[model samples]
Target: MNGTDLLALLPEGWRRVPLKATCNFFVSNVDKHSFDDELPVRLCNYTDVYKNDRVSPDMELMAATATPQEIERFHLEVGDVVITKDSESWNDIAVPAYVEGTADDFVCGYHLAFIRPRKEVLDGRFLFRCLQSRPVALQLELEATGVTRYGLPKDSIGLAVLSLPPLPAQVRIANYLDGEIARIDGLIAEKERMLGLLEEKRAALISRVVTRGLDPNAPLKPSDQDWLGEVPAHWEVQPIKYLAVVGNGSTPSVENASYWSDDGYPWLNSSVVNEPLVIKASRFVTETALKECHLPKIQPPAVLVGITGQGRTRALSSLLGIEATINQHLAFIKPHCDALHPGYLCHWLGHAYAFLRSDSDGAGSTKGAITCEQLANMRIPVPPTGEQLEICAHIRKSLDVAEPLQSEIQNSLNLLMERRAALITAAVTGQIPLEELQP
Candidate 1:
């Protein structure tokens, strides 16, 4: 990231200059707090910068209070660039979001840097594109400091170098990029929308098969529970407690070093529920920790459910493919009877995800937790063992057909993102000629 190395990376017409030479930059300390003495302002917070390419007037910003001095010093304006100065990882450091348009009250919030390009030497849009480029971005990443939480020091931000083109050329490149990027973004949005539809289809398929038998003309019977509605006539509708041994586990004390080891008993947390099948442990707990914590070692053919979480995590289910112990936030259901297949049970739980979440919210738990007792009492449709296996096979076959299509769409998305980044880098660095974009 030295001047010579950066200059070498740029084309002949482009010259390298320190970022501070082309822009006025400052790190903001104004936080998301309101005081009676301070004036009210709409704050462009860290997420606003991290999640968007441009911060515009249409986006809803956080409401906070800032002192007159802070308001004067940190007020946002058009053509200004906001970058994340601090993050949990180095890759996220110095992620820039341009201020496309802003209100008078909009001020930069904490953990972000406000950069205004010196218009005589740099076009704001072009500078923003340069920041998105790999050559300049890599410099910021290398300068980031900290072990757990990374940050770009003010000196590093000021010293970072950029490939500068002539003002007219910068404007031309920016304009070309703006149009091209929009098209790519539109394509990406469509691919993402398709992914959403696929997910909905997958969920619907699982829900339908688990609740109803594979036979199209199967007779239906009322299951008493509103959520259960009508199930296959031959299937038994009963509380889970009758078919499985439902229980939970606990975490060992982290303060005791002996509780954790690299080679020890496999231990999992509620996040395991995110995976359709849990085949490996998240971490390891020592033998003494397992005994002292009274953690139950759940065997295979068990269904794991995230019983506690604030977001969509609650009621998410996963099939345990390996012997493991879980934290208290997870409930393990080990089928004790011969009639129920763990796969079928997991699918049923997946189908019941929304209902379980609703139940958790209405149970009057302030934290939105589903207890072991609640899970145990929940009703499920139980088809014959033979039918359950066939249904599981059918679901897997359906997934096999859908999985490739999803992967193909995902690959297309990856390529589009790569192309977008490469195009921005090429244009900003003058590697691609402006004439190429002309009709």
Candidate 2:
């Protein structure tokens, strides 16, 4: 009812009603397990609903088992809407995706619900746009309940109130929105592609300077590796172990009360490696945990590489700018700075990212994981200390030139997204008149 008060201000032809008045909703319980006693079916899962605006038969769906009863009760039709009913964050509840087509074996999966329109009172496409509006989203966000994970009770969803115009007006609004949204989405995709190309150009610049040095005309020699191809003739190719100490760290036991503290020793995880330089920790561990868990204290001026991750974090390198310990997934490379500068070593490791990932797979370690022993034996080209410093300075200067352009593109992307959200809210709430769309 709190969300419905705003509907009192609606235009003369529109009226407010609880969502259940126009649609029949069901919370699904079909799990992903493939039981031998059940029928095989393709499930319209949580991600399928959350990441998409419409679901069709052509999209890839997970194959699972469901009871005949589940298939009958939860089967999706072209006019039905599926929404995420539960999530780790409250704000993410009730993300709706309209059913665009139907397959006999398709059913709603766990953590989502099915909403079928009564057809006479509600238009499915118009209802979907209303759910996407901020007013409906606010009601769902407030009703979601949980400590670690949030869920919407059936009653809470059934009682959600929204204002609706006549079926004719709903159709017109949906049609206008369809054309405008597609145009905005096209522009957004084009700008995102441009942002990616700019990032690629910046990376290529760093790779060229670090590999070829400041003097492009310098003499070259074969490095005997396909990835390296050739290097400056004066540079020496050496194993990392010969020029630095490679080691790893472990996590303190989280189950023990004494292991954590409000103010304690800094501890880091593999995520910090996403930053070019790490100067802080995400959490803190007690000194007792440090001693009991045998976590090693890594000093500053070391480079950290994410050795294992389920994502692109693996093989990504960062400089350690603060004295802190790390989890086992990160390998700390403390260079013998009289020979290998940490900044130079960090840049070179970043350039070697592709090779590191491939080498890890070839070493027979767990897929996408790298061990400290393998990293210690990895080879790199070593330039003179003075040249390494000069290269680092040149890389910094190049980044300073590129940063402003990247920021400008990112700001443009943000504006486009904000515009998309505003347009949806205006059309669904009757703030934008249908007469204005006559063209």
Best by lDDT: 1
TM-score of 1: 0.70
How close is every model to the real structure, measured as TM-score? 0.70, 0.69
Candidate 2 lDDT score relative to the true structure:
0.87
- Candidate 2 per-residue lDDT, tens place, 63-113, comes to 999989999998899989898999755888999999999988999999998
Cα lDDT for residue 171, model 1? 90
Q: Per-residue alpha-carbon lDDT of model 1 for 229-276, expressed as tens digits?
A: 998889998889999999999878767899999989899877778899
C-alpha local distance difference test of each model: 0.88, 0.87
Off by over 4 Å in 1: 1-6, 13-51, 60-76, 82-96, 104-122, 135-161, 166-168, 216-275, 278-317, 323-340, 353-386, 434-439
Best of the candidates, TM-score = 1
Which consecutive 10 residues in model 2 have the weakest lDDT in total? 359-368
